[model samples]
Target: MEIRDLTPAERRVWRAFPRGRRVDFTDRPPGPERTVRAKVLRALLLTQGAADGEVASLRMTAARITGRLDLKYATVEHPVSLHGCHFDEVPFLYGARVRQFNLQGSHLPGLDAATIHVDGVLRVTGCRVTGLARLGGARISGALFCDGAEFGSPGVATALELNHVSVGRDLYGVGLAAHGTVRLNGAEVTGKVNLRDAVLDAPGGTALNAKLLTVGSNVSLDELQAQGEVRLHGARIPGQLGLTGARLSEPGGTALDVGAVVIGSGADLTGLQAEGRIELHDATVTGPLDLSRARLTAPGGVVLDATSLTVGSNVVLHRLQAEGRVELRGATISGQLNCAGARFTNPGETALRASSCTIGELWLREDSLIEGAVNLRRSQIDMVHAEPGAWPDVVKLDGFVYTALNPRRPARERLPLLERDDDGYVPFAYEQLAASYRRIGDEAGVRAVQLARQRRHRGTLPWYARIWGYLQEVTVGYGFKPLRAAAWLVALLAAGTAAFGLHHPPPLKPDETPGFNALFYTLDLLLPIIDFGQEKAFKPQGGYQWLSYALILAGWVLATTIITGITRALSRQ
Candidate 1:
């Protein structure tokens, strides 16, 4: 910090700036105007070693500069530092070449650093800018810090705009309190963008408009409180985008709109609380997304709409208490989508609509309470780790193809999940469940699911269709229990044989038939498809003919039910 001796004109301007005591004070006392003009100011600075220029770097305290510090389109080679200063008018440093821009603890009306390139850090720590701090197209070779700074006044306008700016190192803005929006659109940062403990408010507008921002490392907005929306649409972050303990409050509008944003690492949005909807439509994350303990509310409407979103790793939503609907349609997760210990409440309407989604595995087992229906139609998951009693009542599993289902209950209790709703209990649902059983080598469970499907299928049919399914299920277990029908047939055969043996039917043609064996006669009438020739030759008279007619009808019913059972068994195999 080798501050050169000031000239008569430079010393006059230095006296106007706040002294060492004023640096700690919050308020600035009035001072005289600057006496050094642009020509004299440039000549005194810009020292080229020792011989070319005799002046040292311009390191001054309390630099209350007047007039527009217009260094635009100029080359400032010397290191300039002016701390604890107050500006009469905003500086115009666009397209200027400065070694460094350290204006910490300064009070400026505005800043227009567009296209200005700084070799060293651009620090404005603890400064209070009353107007816009525009840095569009400005390139900084080192870090850009605004820690403990306040930007913008009270209104719905852009407080800190960094559009198209390129920073070589980190951009730290911790404890930054922006009254209006903070736009970082089209900005590029090689290091992390840490905005931890920042407060950005814009009433009913965007709070942090970070569209198209390309960051090489993480973008942490931890413990941030935004009164309006936080838009990250079209940003490309190569590392994690953490929003741990953040709160976004925007009533009807979207709170966090992150559509089409690409994050190379996971988004750790743990403990995030949003009043409005959080939309992540079409976003691509290459790592795990943990939303554990987050409370996203949009009661009676969609809370989190993540349609077509792609996650490379798992999405952990453990203990997340969400209200309203969560639509994850067409999402593709390479890892598990765990929602254990989570609660989703949206009565009647869909609580979780994950239709056409694909996941490596699903965990919705213990302590998971979803009040509304869960529609996972056409979704494909490798396995489902669920508890039968803890799962939602109405789960739409039509076309939900999963390889395995591990439930903490017996097959009897778990099979009822497929039969709870007739509308969702389609043929594909049964086949999908059967496939899951087959994966675990549970042959009995597979047939049990198929039987339960028939039961549900019977309930959804017309009276005649119901009767047909009922007969098949009761007699043969809808081809699942073929031996059951065999046992019933044997009982009927013995009963019919004894009835005709004691009181034999008088034969119509005595010479056409031999000795009437009652057992053979009963067998002939018991089978509708096969005739043993005993029924055609014999003729029963009076009440005996009624017994013969009843047996013929029973044979037809038994034959059709048996054929149905065989067809179903073959189709399932």
Candidate 2:
């Protein structure tokens, strides 16, 4: 190469000769360092173009440069390694197609470009990139690793759209996009994506939109915060989605809409707080959906409308607090659906109306009080061919108390309190109706349902319950007439004693001794006996007074016999 007039500032670091030489920089201060670094970079770009397909590796080992390196539209047909360079201004590597671009521990920024495709592998590990980085529409052929990269912008209004990109291996963006909006729409990653500890701060709107994204392996978003919505609408994941301790919030609608998604493994979204709805309808998960301690609060209607989702194992939502209806209408889970302590306080129609949801043993809490209707109308419990284990019929509402202003009359007037369709007649509803009909003296209705249940099945109701149903019918409508008959018999005996005498013979004349007239004559002689029986006991004063006591015993015996017969007839009727 010929030596040209490159000024004294640039000539301090002359370019290497045509046949591979080295430069000495022992006694140089860092004054004209930027001028030297720019000249060296320009020469390297020219050499890289000249080699083309000949050069296999261009390893710059241990270089410290401080300048604005511009490699715009230069084709580096070999792997370029800038291991330990520190730049002052932003480096422009726009539209450079290289085999492998390694910039480990490089301090650079302002990488805002379009279609800067890295073919083999782009590793920017341990780089401190300052301004907003944009790689929109770039086709990354291999794994894109930016592990330990520090991006220090206030992370607002930053647009980093990586749409239509395809990474062969893992797209490791760990600590990358620590404060920016990462738009990875329609991208395909073949390996695990680790975005752990990423502080995704997009103030204008969504922090990340991986909608229509397809991942081949696990995606870890542990402790990640997309302050706005995370729009992953139709993403297909071939592994477990680890979103533990993530804050995916939106103001209006949904923060995360995993609708129509096919997750190969489970989704770990424990402690996720979404201010808007989380729609997971028609999504099929191959493993359990762990949503423990997730507070999904939607203001308008439902917080999580996962109506037709198919989870392979348990869909755990333990301690989840949703303000609206948590609608799980047609969801099918293969394991125990543990929604224990989940609170949904929507008072319109139903708080949790799982009408057609098919699942395994539902481990919901007994103390979980739903404020509105609990509509499990056609939901299959213990369905053998539906989900997995036996479907649950018994739901626990421990310590549940409702004080709403419901109408006193039932929805159906012909039915009892437990038989109305609007009322929640769980297990106790039929039980109470069987008891209330027996109480209100409706014996026919009480025996009718029991006999219907008995004739309908071989052994439907218990024997004692049927007996009590019969006896309860009789007791409420039975009359009391035994005491009334005893009063009538005593009145009849008083009338007979006033007309006929006790000691007078029927064949004799009025001259009979000890007749009623004689007795009355003797009583008139001894009015003292009548006054003595009132205050003193067994003091007859004469043998004739004994007839008064015998007549009184006979009258009481006849009254008691008539009362006993009347009571038996009344009870039989």
Best by lDDT: 1
lDDT of 1 by residue, 1-573 (tens): 122555444554333222211122124244433233333345445423333324335555565666678777878776666677777788888789888888888888989888989999899998899899989898999999999999999963989999889999999999999988998988999999999999998979999998989999999999999999998999999999999999999988899988899999899999999999998999999999889999999999899999999999999989998899998999999999999999999998889999999999899866888999889889999888888876677878778888878763556877777765427547887778777777777878888887887787788799999988877777778778879878878987888898999888877788777678888898888787787788988888788778888778777877887887778767766
Model 2 global lDDT (CA atoms, 0 to 1)? 0.60
Output the lDDT of residue 171, model 1: 96
Could you tell me the lDDT of residue 104 within candidate 2?
77
Segments of candidate 1 deviating more than 4 angstroms: 1-9, 12-43, 46-55, 422-425, 529-532
Error of 2 at 212 (Å): 0.9
What's model 2's TM-score?
0.62
lDDT of each: 0.82, 0.60
- Top TM-score hit: 1
When superposed on Cα atoms, how far off is each prediction in RMSD? 4.0, 15.2
Residue 251 lDDT (model 2) = 65
